[model samples]
Target: MSDTTPRIETERLVLRVPRIEDFERYAELLADEEACRFIGGHMPRPAAWRRFLQMPGAWAVQGFAMFSVIEKSSGLWLGQLGPWQPDGWPGTEVGWALHRDAWGKGYAYEGAAAAIDWAFAHLGWTEVIHCIDADNAASQALARRLGSRVLRQSGMPAPYEHVVVDVWGQSREDWQVRRSTRA
Candidate 1:
């Protein structure tokens, strides 16, 4: 991870830049069909390796990318979530994909909230989006909890172009207002 990479800590999770050591657990998350269904679905080990490397590469090229979500109590890798905007993306986004075991917990929202804060405060991002599949009620709920609503409908880039998603988001000012209300 870069020296400049910021590590964010929530009540029960730690979010840091993706490291090589995270590949094994990260691969496991990608390998689980049900866990990945709303995302890109499951992939073979070799394909998982490539997907694993994308986060670090994105940080190197874009100066920002998803953080590897770690459970603080168990010190285990849970998943990855944070700022992500590759070429031809609809807009700057804060995404989440957790391990099946991490499901039903509040880690996704906890980690993503910190990430969205970082993006708006440090990355100069005016808004943050969550490209959720129409069928992904869980993610939609998470977005709602974060005070986001479907701004529009769009398709992902190549390889996922056929997958239509609801672009849920809110501007930095809106996020701040919500955060304050929560406090």
Candidate 2:
């Protein structure tokens, strides 16, 4: 794997490392009820900061983790999106979350495509997985848009019982074909 951090740019978004300054914007999104519904529910600012500080290290240590998604034109923090390989996970987890206002704009698809592309291109990762809450229709739609196939039905970690989810994945070969066709 390349030691270099891959920077992926979509038409209107920039997927980059999260900094201390991003906490405020990120915290707000994390605390948003609608936005956080699927991702272990809402979290306080302190917990959000703690997670932010640990993400890049996760990426460096495991070769993949969620990254901050920003708007290129305004340089505004939009949300977080990336491929996370959390311990005990079966495959790379493709995840993302955007503030409520950023919804319906196709930002999720744009950011996710770039990050998934980076995962295959830089890390030689053959499969990118998207584990989303079962009821989250939007995310399920987005996973389908990325050409990810549902691999299994699974449950969320502790404190999130009763919330079953679908695990979606796409192989590198499929990703390459999808990207090529889009181009």
Best-matching candidate per lDDT: 1
Q: Report the lDDT tens digits of candidate 2 across residue range 80-136.
A: 888787655657777888888789999999999888878777777888899887788
TM-score, per-candidate, Cα-based: 0.97, 0.90
**Clash counts for the predictions, in order:** 0, 0
Q: After superposition, how far is residue 36 of candidate 2 from its true place, in Å?
A: 0.5
- Model 1's alpha-carbon lDDT is 0.92
Error of 2 at 126 (Å): 1.3
**C-alpha-based local distance difference test score of model 2:** 0.82
For residue 110, what is the lDDT in candidate 1? 94
CA shift at 32, candidate 2, in angstroms? 1.0
Candidate 2 residue pairs that clash:
none
